[model samples]
Target: MSVPTRQASPAAPPPASVLPAVPVEPSPDPEAHLGLRFPEGFGWGAATSAYQIEGAAREDGRGPSVWDTFAYTPGRVANGDTGDTAADHYRRYAEDLDLIRDLGLRSYRFSISWPRVQPDGRGAINQRGLDFYRRLVDGLLERGISPMATLFHWDTPQALQDDAGWANRDTAYRFADYATAVFEALGESVPVWLTINEPKTVVQNGYITGHHAPGIRDEPTAYLVGHHLALAHGLGVQALRATGSASRIGGALNLHPCYAADDSPATSDAVRLYDGYENRFYLDPMFKGHYPEDVLADQGPGSPLVRGIRDGDLEIIKQPIDILAVQYYTPIYVTTDGGTVQKWPTTQAAWQQVYPPGMYDILTRVTRDYAPPSITVTENGLPCADEVGVDGSVDDAGRISFLRDHLAEAHRAIADGAPLESYHVWSLMDNFEWEVGYDQRWGLIYVDYPTQRRILKRSAAWYRRVISDNSL
Candidate 1:
């Protein structure tokens, strides 16, 4: 697609000077970390997204999503694997909920496919599509689990993507309408509603690097899409509030704590710029009511993101949110020349760096800066190259260590005054991982793709005990 004509936009007032407000709280005595404990009423759960697991793509009046398009493309996904029969969850959710209950989960976080409810992303409602979620939610409630639903998880309806997707401001309004429709249907049965999941991924991976669905490598369009996504988030929150339901709403952001690769003054600028691109770009708009001036300036004049800003757009993009859902997998260490270095051990997923301390820093930083009413560590898990042992048991020791260390950091964060209310592993069972396909497994339960068998890994068993004891 040729670069679209830049829309002429008027001047919007610049935000105040930007600076990092990260302050790490001093930890308790080192001995206190030996045995970790959580407060009463803390939530324990697992999470999954619709496209990654729900595989009835053409059934029950469900429409196509960008994932369907991207995976079917010649070379987008690894091993040519698609989500066509992902863990067979659409047909196996009853057993899946039983697994959640067996694991002693009190809450479950899942996403709603936009095209599933309204096939074209707007217009008519698909009752059968909504019915599946109704059954899923009811099943969770029946199994003594609270449901948390995310409206969009990187699966834009193909129709929406065909219509310029998030690059067009109209898509934001459509999202609000879609959100209001879901709110009316689901009501407040879902205690927490996440408007968008990792908009940064859409901006960075989907648009900038073309590594994700609806892939496009146009830098000019990425941040414009980012702006529209944030707009959708605010609009969705407003729509939920207007529903008169008691549901808590927020945005699910993947924040990577940035640090200087070396103790050099030159690297400080790179770190700030990296932080601006990776974190503050989204954080400032939600909490401070303005786009990060550094990011806007980096886009420069006449860029789509800079040229497309309209008066009152920022107003719609900044509003009160009840929860701030965080998905932390790694941290970015910036070098002097705007490059990155991996200072910590990596994971099966090459992008992830196993630095548990980043979790504590991030939680405390968000609490100290944004001060969200409540925080939830929605997605944190290690993707292991898992295999079943000869004894027919899956053992993921790395995952167990990953979870234990990360949970210790989370406990430290809470002890230091982050209003963290819940923690959910990235997944309950292995399924089709986007782009990487089934190559990387990030689930507590091992999934046999051929037989649709579910076997709880050692990590799941370990997590069950932690949840039961409220300590580790």
Candidate 2:
């Protein structure tokens, strides 16, 4: 299980001006009269997905995914980028595992490509695909790092999309079958499983907005896809239970706390609308077994898209989950003009707002409002225009501050008794960022794409100390 050595890329030239100075904040130093420490046994790790990092796209009996199709379609991605050979993690898992071990990570969260496992999306097991993961899991074990597997992270088999995608209900059943296949194959070793990663992103980006894979810009189709994907998650969880796998299963939701930009009634209503569409649409079904009434009301009378929730669908979806995987990068600042709600303070992604406090706020709300479940901050990291210094070290001070602020909030949430179990940074290496492509770097490890070099950023070293000390 030896990973081939990759030559380090020549460090990028330093930026003409240093990053804007980070604002100083209060600290928890005991000598300074404040005392704080992360909870005993809080898990710390990093996350990476298959399509984003595993660049052997066409290798080992793997079939094309929607990303593969979208990336090739002229202007779908930034800078004409495609993940055909992004980080080559498929061939470099061993080296990546060493990197994980070096970071003193207790767990490594990685996604299994559905197309890679079931090349045509169903009916056949791709042994080579299984072999790659088996090797990866074994490498992690060899280094004493637990493997946390995400079943689907937006890389649906293009074959399935060609056959109607999530707009059709049958896709739910297919996803269940796929989940069972993955569980039966790797459940013995992998103790933690995530059923899906951010269904909202899948439906909104892929169908409604036409910004991501299998791009289709129809609002009705997007709503349908969203419902079907939720059903798929329910069915997938049921399938995992039916297989009697020992692994604990759940879904990773990209949840953000919604806020009104002002105290106006329109602004408050805007916040409510955003919350219905973003959080409650998924949370209510998973915890309370139905979509929120407000979400249905907001859909209005014109749309023919009805949620095809049949008898017993709620019961199936209410299946007990061992943990809730929460991926919080930023929050949404909502405002209203007349009768229209719009996002405010947009990021490079043009949708998210940089609201770090939202991390603590959302975690608190989930714990207080929903049935208590073990929670993990599965994805929390910032994308910065990182640059290597003249001395060859990348000085990503913004990212470092981002991590510190978020983790401090996480500590506060835990202190207030929010069943917090673990924290995993969004990424380990800067790889493909869906439609935005490689332009944004979200990893603690700086990736020199051309030479496939892995440079530990300042944040990575800081996080390493956090892990070693078992405190934030």
Top model number, TM-score? 1
Q: Model 1 scores what on Cα lDDT?
A: 0.84
- How well does candidate 1 score on lDDT at residue 4? 11
**lDDT of all predictions:** 0.84, 0.78
Q: List model 2 lDDT by residue over 1-472, tens digit each.
A: 0000001000111111223333322234311211358877778989989999999989989999999999999998889999999888998888989999999999899999999999888889899999898899989989999899989888889888889888778888899998888888777698889988888787666776677788887766676677788888889889988988878888888887877667889778666766787788889888888887776775654543444656887787778898999888666555553122223333344344456688899999999988557998788876777888889898776666667778888889998888988999978998998887888788889999989999999889888988888775
Candidate 2 stretches greater than 4 Å from native: 1-35, 301-304, 337-348
Best candidate according to lDDT: 1
TM-scores, one per candidate = 0.93, 0.90
**Residue-by-residue lDDT tens digits, candidate 1, 1-472:** 0001111111211211222322212133212325777999899989999999999999989999999999999899999999888988999999999999999998999999899999998899999888999999999999999999999998899999899999989999999999998999989889999999988888877887787888897778888999999999999999998989998999998888989879999989877877888888888999889887877887788889878888887887788899999988887777777766667766666667778999999999999999999999889887777899999998777777777788999999999999999999988888888888888788999999989999999889888988898887
Give, for candidate 2, the lowest lDDT window spanning 10 residues: 1-10
Q: After superposition on all CA atoms, what RMSD does each candidate show versus the true structure?
A: 6.9, 7.5
Error in Å for residue 242 of model 1: 0.9
